[model samples]
Target: MAEAARGLGWHPFPGPAAVNSVRYQNRAACAYHGFCDRGGCHLDAKNSTAVSTIPRAQETGRLQVVTEAHVRRVEVDGEGRATGVSYLKGGEEYFQPADVVLLASYTYENVRLMLLSKSPAYPDGLSNNGGQVGRHYMTHATGAGVLALFPHRLNRWYGLPAQGVAIDDWAADNFDHSDLDFIGGGNLWVYSDRRPIAAARMPTFGRAPRWGSAWKAFVADNADRWTNCYIQKSTLPYEDNYLDLHPTVTDPLGDPVCRITADFKDNERRIATFVQDRMVEWFRAAGAVEIIRQGLGTMGPSTHAYGGTRMGDDPETNVVDRWGFSHEAPNLGILGASVMGTSGSHNPTLTAQALGWRTAAHLVENWSSIAG
Candidate 1:
């Protein structure tokens, strides 16, 4: 891939060193033939749960795989302890009893399920005694790369996201932000994962009309000449930015959908502008012909949503304790990005997986104390 990049007479620089904490085999040194980011590895070379953890757990005779179970709520006994969960399979309802229960759903769903499960012991919501279940919700403010025009075809049709170059000089607290308006920072990514179908969709640099013959010609002419600059910025949680069950909106299962109320603040806008300046500097240094900067739009519910069930020692402010166990509901553990307190300007999946491991280990080490 480096040789192919150099063949186009490009600088082919390794922007910076960043480690990807993936559970699977390292793709950074692999052939990286473009499609690894999409439908996953065809050869099952990736170490996802389906290929790695699940199969090992299935080897144990005690593991039972229940498919198509839509969990409604975690049932608690009169003493405010989790007894088990109630879920739906097909059109019938079933109750599964257990000594301990872990809510491993995504950020929004984790809070949603907790809010949905109510009992006389805790009227407001499950584990919401201090009303902090959905507070401090946040997501990493994602910025797509500046759609830049390259001077020549770099043959960007090959390579994966893991094979990309990254510039972290502006990410997190790498540089001084005391004089700046924003408190957080972002990482700059330059990937060569240009698929043909995606490259054909670049806006025609105002050279031709957006529709009709001119548009078609422009796409064909500039398909290889266009690329992007991606920035993943650290976003801090605010009191107003939160997640809650939608008042009127219901899902197919008659449950309230998780409603997200978040948007990019002035701090993020300032950071985006600053990151754009730095990206332009790097791109111009790399011989980019044209750079078009974009804004940090309103945030939407993404896989990276965090902090709804934050983990901390204080029960008044956080939902889960430092070990991912609920402060109010004993034997109830949460294992997802929701327990995260900070947005680290990177993908949270690997960190969440590690936290899940830590939570499981903690449970096993203190099983007798917790379950009893």
Candidate 2:
């Protein structure tokens, strides 16, 4: 597949992954269990914070992990500065005070928490006096997909999602876009991720019935003969695509849930269409007998959600400053993709972690000024 991509003038290489390839830091290496895609790694080989950073922080005796706590709002003082947070635990409400507050509860929840924490000093919401808390929102354009069928088995029963070849030549301004209708591109990935249940549910390509002997026969023969390519395109935030409190729906706690008003614009659709064509060509070059292309669907909730508390230099257009601190509430910091202003073609995890470390370092270096 890498050779095929290189033949098309695209840069292809092994996709970067966070899973441990060998034993490190007393953690076991990847066992190739193949269930890492949807299930937890029993060997603790995946580099999740729960198994990595949290354990290290706990050893310092300064970090506390409170399980089953539902944070409701951020408490503020008369001067519109964050004081702490109020949460519900064991059917009792409690307030935890702090000198500095950091909100890192993912994108949607971060926006929702800020919106729900309205105070007398800031009547709209926390850090929302300028109404920019949820202005710019985006999710990766990841719906467009291409499935290919090969004549022989791929033997892909044992591998992880990251064990694949990726072509980034079409990703995010890497190639010429002067004559193109869109500004961003997509990253094409073909990985070894096959589960028995999911493989049995493969599309028959109009070769068999929906269910019965013919379908069972088709599944038995073609379950290991097909594969899909993942195409993640760059998405942009727009004025109309924002998040807000749902007027009608509420959670079990009676608090309003987040309401998303978003959709893929023309630029995203154009990129998906263009990239899928390239993907089909690549699959054909790799000896695919039949290929199925999916359409550019409407944008929905995504794991790669970004930008509800956008970071920027201007307070009027952004919620946080360049350092990820709130422009209105100086001591309040955000530590997730919610502060990201743009969604690139790649996953936001590494960038988010890097930004988080940067924020933490800045806070430690300027603790006196920020915590005050």
**TM-score for each model:** 0.89, 0.97
Task: Write out the backbone clash pairs for model 1.
Answer: 145-229
State the lDDT of candidate 1 residue by residue for 1-372, as single tens digits. Answer: 234334434334464312233434433333456556656765455546766677778889778979999999888888889989999999899999989999987898899999999998678778988899998999877664577777787788776665577666678897787788878788777876778888877977777899899899888888988888667877888899998899999999888999888877888777777887777767766677777877655564554788899999999999999899999988999999999998877778788989999999999999998887
Please give the CA lDDT of all the candidate structures: 0.79, 0.91
Clashes of each: 1, 0
Stretches of candidate 1 above 4 Å error? 1-41, 211-214
Candidate closest to the true structure, highest lDDT: 2
Model 2, which residues run further than 4 Å from truth? none
Model 2, 166-247: lDDT tens digits are: 9888899998998899989999999876888888889997788989999999999999999998898988899999999999
lDDT value, candidate 2, whole model? 0.91
